[model samples]
Target: MTETAEQAVQFVAMARKSFPALSSMRGSGGPAAAAVRSAAPMASHFLRRRGEDLLMKAVQVETEAGLANVREIAKVEGLDMVFFAPVELAASAPRGQEAGLLLALETAEAEVKRAKKLLGGMLVPGRSAEMMFAAGYDLVCTTSDVILVRAAAENIVREAKPPATGPKGGLVRFVTSGREAKFARNDETLVTRLKKSRQARALGALVRLGSAAAAELVAASGFEVVVLDHSRGAEDLLGAVALVHAASRAGAHSLMRVPALSQAHLRRALQVGVEGIILPGVESAEEAHALVELCLYPSRNLRDDSHAAEARLKNQPFRRMDFSFAPPLVEFYGQRVAEFSRRQGEALLIAAQVDSPEGAAHIREIVKVEGIDMIFVDAMRLSGADVERIETAAKKHHRLLGGLLVPGCHVEDMYRAGYKLVCAASDHGLLAEGAKACLKAERPVE
Candidate 1:
């Protein structure tokens, strides 16, 4: 044989040796081709699972018998994702909970053949079906088993007694801070899916973005909340307005962590549609009080414009609108027109971060301040003693206590430490980790 032919033969041998599974999957034609075509939408569904978006609604099936229940569950509108649970456990669920357990295997749009196409295989143990479901929501949000058990737990909770704190809806929220990206771009396919996921995960994570185009993808990829961090020098506060719009489109609970405690910054953030503010370096009750008042729409302003037209603050001189006259407000106005104080009107949330020793000393006083919903201790900055101090104050005041997700620490540990809300590492960190993981994956034999 010629040298080139010998090299080609070696390459073919290596390719066959590397892709043993591909040989089994070689005949993915006819029915499989049709399955791939039909499952394209399912592929998009997995990618679109955004942080602020709704958890893609799913129902469970355990056995062939469960297929009979599938059509019944599909009746629930907007129900898309489907997972399979262990029959022994799922059989115990009561009727009300059953609505959430059953999923459609065949429907007006889907036949059993089409449903099989989406999953590609039955979700038995060690099957890829389970993995497909895990990727249904945020990879960090949960695993496939958690979804199955949560449903069963909810059923048990409902049967035994009423929930201790209602249905923990929107309780397990994640907040991710944005890092300055020198070159931040995501896959065009992923960007498209992120847009799709926004509509569903609209209520997920709070995030900060560095720029608009690429950073907007950060907002889209399930971390819908825009965290306008101090370090992200995006021209001015005005630039953050577009970030807020992107977050809004994603249906995120937008929360900004400002550079400094400026009334102008607070006003601009709120006007653009920030649902919450994370006040950093909070020290005293006086600071907490100022943060609350400025965070609120002026009660007096509603009575009449008078001096309200001038949106000027003590040192800040720019005159701009204070309240959010954006689409959310516009929708509210369309429903009913009324002038009322924000004390009774607005649903905005205010969070104070205790990062300094002075803040620790005044934690009790700060918690006493009304209008605030959470007390965040900067666990990354403070000592263990400081976190306990802030946590005690938070529990005493019935306010949610939050902190950063410490490296190498389990989220369960943070919860046990009495931290209800935990901010994850920066987006850049996650991206770096992902890149490292991708590089670490073994390639096919050469």
Candidate 2:
């Protein structure tokens, strides 16, 4: 089997453990779903190959004759039949995006049902994941890798930390800063939006597992930001690029939570289009300052400006979809990129995770460091008093505060306690809870 086929097998093995009765799970044959979260360059590749490869290969190859041959081979090989629809053909279609998708869905559904094979809709768009499952898709693979790893990482962190007291362990009211209020009225960033409208309390989904398709789906749900948690999830440079691109395509801002304060991690994340980076385990003002420097270009130190720096600095400007310039304006764009690079520390947000007592003690000083956008405390790592100290320091420094809100922790209380950014839940948490609810409702004890 090909490497892609092997991944499908792994997915099948993983799925069977959850639903023993499931006979088999198939992989998506189309490139879009196959490539959605696969790597960063996949989208550009697909776009460039629109005329020949996408149409001829995807649409034509997934025909009845081709599928029948595959079905026979699968039976001979003792494998289950998995049908892939030509969803990628939607982009190459003569019709518009929506019309292409509707046509492909109708055609693929019929073909897969006729052959008695499991329909595999790779990279289901928008809220179509829910609808596909409801339409009786045996198994739907929304995303994989980083998302799952992050879920496990978060669970481990939660388990290792101190448990909360009774529900609503510490309650405090949160107020937006004057600067935040001003930004809300002017900037399009997630922070600004949340501040502008109290009712616009933005909810974000953390992609712990490296599923760009899943991230895209979450983005479709109207989240202001989608966080790719590298601190707890299994992700490398390529995976981060894919997740960030996918989130942006789905109209959501992307944030990456790095494991530590490192230049390599920060530089790569910025290059790949993350709007912000969350630095976990920040314990001192010096460390916080260093983290900010890592994210910024042209720090106080003297360094030669190389051709590579120019190219990478230009990467940020290319992030905007409509960023086009005239041939004569090339020099102007270059100057803009150069200036943007110097002041990037001010433009890009820096978030620090304070999960240790040492970090809590230095919270005031850490917040004083410029570019430290928000401070998130792990509820398990800090007690009521510890939280109070952090809150007091935040007020003094005039910085925004944030935290992780697990179950039984009252959201209102956290807000009252002055948490501007509270990650109430994650993708894996929601999935597990939803599954348990389904099982409980359908399979009650006698």
TM-score of 1: 0.44
Q: List, residue by residue over 258-299, the lDDT tens digit for candidate 1.
A: 767775466556555455678888999998877876664333
lDDT of each: 0.49, 0.57
Best prediction by lDDT? 2
Candidate 2, superposed: residue stretches over 4 Å from native = 1-186, 191-200, 298-337
Off by over 4 Å in 1: 1-209, 212-221, 231-235, 300-340, 343-346, 442-446
The best candidate in terms of TM-score:
2
Clashes of 1: 19
lDDT of 2: 0.57
Q: Tens digit of lDDT per residue, candidate 2, span 1-446?
A: 21133444454444334432111223335665456536654553444334222221111223333333443332222134454433222212221122344454555566545656555544444435778777656666565454466568769966655445735434533467653563344455655554455444445678786877778877887766788888888878687767877887777877778887754456556666576778888899999877766665332111233344445434431222111111111111223333444334334566778888889888878888876777767758777777788888876776667767745777777777666766766667666888999999999699
Error of 1 at 73 (Å): 71
